[model samples]
Target: MNLDDLAEKAEEYRARDAGITHEVRVCVAAACQSGGSLPVLEALKAECDSGGTCKVKGVGCMGLCSAGPMVAIAPKGGAIPDSILYREVKPEDAADVLASVGGAPVERLHTPTDQPFFARQQRIVRENSGLIDPESFTGYVAAGGYAGLIKALSEMTPGDVLREMTTSGLRGRGGGGYPTGLKWSTVAKMPADQKYVICNGDEGDPGAFMDRAVLESDPHRVLEGMCIAAYAIGATKGYVYVRAEYPLAVQRMELAIRKAKRSGFLGSKIAETQFSFEVEIRLGAGAFVCGEETALMASIEGLRGQPRPRPPYPAEAGLWGYPTLINNVETFANIAPIITHGGEWFAGIGTAKSKGTKVFALAGSIKNIGLIEVPMGMSLREIIEEIGGGCPGGKAFKAVQTGGPSGGCIPAAHLDIAVDYDSLKTLGTMMGSGGMIVMDETCDMVDVARYFMEFCMSESCGKCIPCRTGTWQMHELLDRITKSKGTHKDLALLEELCDVVQATSLCGLGQSAPNPVLSTLRYFREEYEAKLTAE
Candidate 1:
């Protein structure tokens, strides 16, 4: 088949296949694999081996990695009425799942589609997540993947694209919460011959994998988003700077890019439009500092990946000294939707301030630790108790670590606090790249602060003394506190040092490094005082 014919044939096959075959997609992703998905896969295969024409495919990942060994069954028609999403599947549950092939509906494995985790989520960025095979371009296309790019190129003007984003209330998911439209407008208006769009996949936060999951589960979604972004911002070249640690995510993204290029979805005049866009992959050397925009830009340019001070922001002077629109993976993933469906539709979903759903890598002591996307204005108590299924060991909820080492810890008393940008900041935390780690009573608050302090100290870029030296000093003090060797004077010293670090820090690394310490002290002052009293 020629290129056009092959494309047509692929589309026809996908549609036809969707009708005749029953797709039993099992999660063989990293998180699910660790939770015994292989055995579940074997069991499903064994059932399929004994029987009829059931297509049991091993897909990349479901965002709900914690509720692993997940299973989804797509019936022989045009998508089942909410495809059966089975969590915590075991090998023994295989027969019941397979036996339900004829639409009996497996009662035990069926997860309600109307729950807060699924219901509250407006899956624009993560549309293909947990649904399509991350490696397959055909699968993505089948799920209305490139349609947004098609819509953008065919109908929306560059100005229109920028305007829609501004109206959509889409903010940067890359921690800063900058208006995406304004950022794009800057790059679009910049007086530069060569402009670049960058996808920041260098997700360095300790328990944060929302970006990694999107890259692994829906790489093409990100690619489609980037392509649309390049068109929107008048950029010819783009790059995705992902960290080296996410081997699977990198591999999947690389494969997706190749397929997209081969299918004429990425190259010159994509889908027969005047816009031409191409993207390259730059692998970061696993430097945590690279998560910073300047640092990420520097690393992409083959430098040491350190952050320089900002008057020449990336939009003005970026990679190779050209205008660049750098957005996080999740940020880019939201582009297509803002294009396809009007921005108003998206804006209506979440809170007035924080529009659209936020995806999080929910982990730690929670019973249902996994990746979840919830709308803004949801209470922390609701998330922990209702959506997350509460603490695993039935222990008392202690605190939650939002935003990463650079984030703060929320005590149990503040569980009712609304989880929005302003609210989190008011509580001495920021709605950082959405990593919510639940801690139970077993966790030592002093140790938690010390752990995050150490992470910040180790990951500090050392470009600024406040982050480099201050984080170390704070960590040392925290170490003393946790080890029962701290005095009242040391506690005072830790508080004072956190303030100095916050005041004098450069970039977000130094600035937010004291957040965990500050927030912990605010809520858990008694805990710190208790340690000293015990000593």
Candidate 2:
């Protein structure tokens, strides 16, 4: 029942079950709930209940929210050709769904292998996502998981680990896109008696669930990633700062941490290595500002989470005034792969500037709406039309608002722009936590800017003058424009405020808060101009 024995048992169980039968897994996540996954689960359950040849399992979100009520059928064992994925399942079609397990083809429900959505996806962070029960730790280890952590601890040294990460060109996925190895190296070089590694899981961006999916589906991956990071950074303590809204993710992570501790994967020397590390969870009370590093560290220390003026950055002085390395959940999830597979392999996948794959919670007007990961250079058009299955209801793709409220909207003219940190920044946008929301013609640009400005205004920490007051003023102007009560002077004033906030803001939340407005103005200034004249 110890960690070591459990890991062994997990491997044994996987081998033993390698030839059992077959199973069809139905997703019962929130997205699927909206898509009526309960009915699909019930149908699968009924089919399995009635002496069906296959077993049925219920799982968490697969990141494919558009095609909900999704199911993945494994051929009992690890049979050939991989398991088939079915989307948009209905209750009445359960019998037909079950029939597709062996030979029959439920043409309507099937997601073709050649489809763009699955064709290019390389699932690493999402490896165990749709297939395994999130609550089951054993299910995770059985799926070639934890082997990475074991490899890192039992084989590689801290310096070696950092080298692999740097060479791999893995950047932070929490919108910053800083090189992962460089961040760790800075923390490692800092002279400190004690150091901390923190996982920034307070994902507040709208229409983004990359972190939540990892926590909900493969909690161990994040944990293992953290452990590897701890080893690399020579840290003994760590915290996973998740949002309170994600009760399910928090529950699963808590369970996972406990399981890891009991199995000796956490707490003390793991896998008989000389190093020791432990992880704890700090739940945020839904404060969007806490996603910032300094604020996150403040919250962990039981203080009111607010951003302070930097210079004593978290890298040098953070989390109880010691050196700390803070990285987002998705960024941490990539650690194991880099450690196990080597950095060159990872660096080879994405674009020249931004290395490694980016997992996007593909929602909005796209067709095959769900969770997807593609290389860095993939075009927005490919993502929207090809992978996202194009806009639903025959609507023309108007624009995509990447980076949530903090990111700019790239209109149809720039749909071909490659997605990466530098590339997006060049287009007056930054890759902000991989939130790609599609917009159709019905979505007014002015209104969209107003909506996101409202969000930024509400989420603003009020600690800085530029963000606290600037964003509020911008919101007021936008509100007037949306209601058709604005004039030409307002537009000029808006530009002035954007300059002030972008230049004087303390942190990223304020610095990037003007992106939505700026990008909208760049692409759709006419919308604001038209609003200047009232009837």
Candidate 3:
């Protein structure tokens, strides 16, 4: 299809939608689905069909994942403002929920939009989240989707797309803070006939759901970004490496890719241009290391998933020895917006070093346990206290874990620190895929470190000695310490192991595995020291 066809489709969908009196959006994302959103959606659909006043549509994550299954209702021609949200909704409550549409409010079920949990989030990556039916091509087009891809395909050349990306100042959102434009430029510059763009969606972090939310909420957004990236880097093929665990995300993305190809946004000759791109989903068998760029490409190639050294990085020779462009879900999600709104507009959002908003999956010990997209420089205190609504009980906040097992923990004293890349690293933490797990005073720091060490130890692919053995040894030491049977030498040995692993590990996984141990040592040495024997 052509540009006018896309616009015409959008307008047609909008026109059809405007005629409906009430539209009900049921959160059918993994979180809400587990909370019985499917049954609730069925109930709403049945009720709406019976009445015809309200039409039910299953949408993506509504962000307040903690209080689900959630549903939002709005009168036609009006968006979220005219909508009313209901939290902790049940299948039986669907009838009552429908009654509240254009009528009186349900006091117990109503979730206000003005709350800091909703108000504070600047949702660029998640702009379509909770608002659109993710599976609907017409719905996405109606919401100004594919315009970026159309713009890239029709108006600008591939070089122009790269220039716009370079101007945006966007960085890799998948742990490493590499420049997005620089990576694309490297792949573009690489002299290869076959380059590939891979979207790393194997989000295996213990508490991180950021990538999954993006994939579930806005699959087309990621697809569009992939299309733009493919066009920019001269790559004709792409793969989305998602974990087998995230069935819903995989399902949605698979559907979206099929729809995208059929709509001509992806696959052969898009917008009547000679440039062609094809995307496929490669399911990762729950390996955390596959989230790494090299490992992910290896997985896509039907090999054992493990990371290799990165000088001849993915840019030069990757994915069957041709140049490859790798980025995660959130990174891709940012591309469409950066293209639509000029690069300078995006550059103006966050701190000087870290540009654009970061989507975080706030989990553990927080009141508002959900997905949120906040400006990069937002303070840890603001996220934990204000947006996340702080620790649930009267207990004082203890620490917040910024990254996953590969990241360190920041104590309560450093809560004022901005949640940017460099700032977090200074405090002994890196933004590891935006999995921010808040901890309260009740959490034992020693046990917390042990818990994460256990995760790294388990998730290690055992391909390298440092990651495999070091993580195991560290877990052993932490296990001894947390069990209250450790001596001073154990702590020294653990510190030594951290240094060895950080210095010598073959991949980012092994290298950063010691983060939890190191950061805890830096911030809460008292906790570790208290557990030690007097000898």
Candidate 4:
């Protein structure tokens, strides 16, 4: 399909939708589905079919996961935020919901859109998440889905795309915060005839579902972003490596690929241009290490998922010894927007070094638990108190863990710090895929350190002694301290092990495995000291 054909498709879909007076959207994403959204969806559909100007459809996550099964009703061509939202909806509420679509909203079921949980988010990656039917290709097209790819193909050259990316200052969202434009340029400059682009969807971090939500909610958006990356970097083939645990995400992404291929967006001569790229889905065995780029490529090659030391990184040598460009689900999801709105427009948001927005999954003791995206320079206090609604039951906020098993926990003393790549590093943490688990006053810091250490020890690939044995040793010492069976020597020993593991580890998993222990000790050392037995 050419530019004109794409526009015609979008117009046709919009024209068909214009006839409807009201639309009812049900959150059918995994979170809401588990909360019984499917039955609600079917019930709403039955009511809409019985007779009304109302149409019912299934959408992706609405962000307030605790409030599901959520429903939204909107006027034709209206935005989702302005829609009448209903929380914890039941199947029997369908008739009342449909009846009150353009009339008075069901007061008992109504959820205010003006709440901080919904209003505070700056959605770039999740802009279309709760708005469209994820499985509908025409629905995505009508929402201006692939316009960025078509624009890149018909108007801009490869260098121009690269330049736009550079101007946008987008960083890799899969942690490490590497510049996206630099990585793409490196892959594009490679002298190989065969190049590959891989999207890392193995989101194994605890309390993190940002990637899964993006993949399931706006599968076409990811595909369109991948297509844009392929065109810019001259990649003929690509693979999305998602863990088997995310069945819904994999299913939606697979369906999106098929639809795009049928519409001439994935096969030979995409958009009727010289750019031709094909994408496939590769299921991971739920190995946490495979979230690392090298290990992800190894899994794609049908080998044991493990990380090798990097110098010849994925951008240099990857996937069958050819140049490969690897980016996480969120990084690619930002591509279309950057291309559509120039890179400078994106650079205008966020901080000086870290531009664009970051999507975070809020969990633990927070009252408003769900997915959210905010600008880079947003303070941790703002995220926790304002957006997350602080801790539940008025318990004082104690600390929050960032970056999952490989990250450090920030105590209440540093809550006002800006959450950028550099600021997090200064606090002895890195943004490892944007998972934030808040803690309250009752939590024991020593146990929190042990818990994450246990997770790392279990997930260790055992390829390196530092990660394999070091994590185990750290866990044991923390366990002893928590039980009040360890002396001062044990605390000193734990500190030394953290140093060794951080300095001598083979991969990121081993290296950052000491973060929880170190960060907790740095801020809450009194907890460990109080637990220690007399020498």
Q: How much lDDT does each candidate structure score?
A: 0.83, 0.84, 0.89, 0.92
Best by lDDT: 4
Query: What is the TM-score of candidate 4?
Result: 0.98
Error of 4 at 403 (Å): 0.7
> What TM-scores do the predictions have?
0.93, 0.93, 0.97, 0.98
CA RMSD, predictions in order? 3.0, 2.7, 1.4, 1.1
Compose the digit string of candidate 3's lDDT tens values, residues 87-182.
989888877888787888798999887788888889899888888898888889999899888877877888988988898899999989999999
Count of backbone clashes, every candidate in sequence: 0, 11, 0, 0
Encode model 1's per-residue lDDT on 1-535: one tens digit a residue: 1234444655775765643467788886678878898889888887885345677767766566766888888664233236778888999999889778758667777876666666555566666676677777877776667777777787789888888988999889977889888999999999878999999999999998889888888898899889888888899999999989988888888998899999888878787667789889999997888999999998988889789999799899998889999999999888887787888888897777888888888899987777877777788998888878788867988889999987899888889987788888898888899999999999888888888888888888888888899999998989988888899999888889988999988888888888888888889888888888443
Q: Of 1 and 4, which scores higher on lDDT?
A: 4
Runs with alpha carbons beyond 4 Å of true place in candidate 4: 1-4
Best candidate, TM-score-wise? 4
Candidate 2 structure quality by residue, lDDT tens digits, 29-121: 667777888777877687665454567777777666776778877776342127677878888888887777778668878776556677667
lDDT of 4 by residue, 325-366 (tens): 999999999999999889989999999999989999999999
Rank candidates, TM-score, best first.
Answer: 4, 3, 2, 1
lDDT measured at residue 489 in model 3 versus the true structure, 0 to 100 = 95
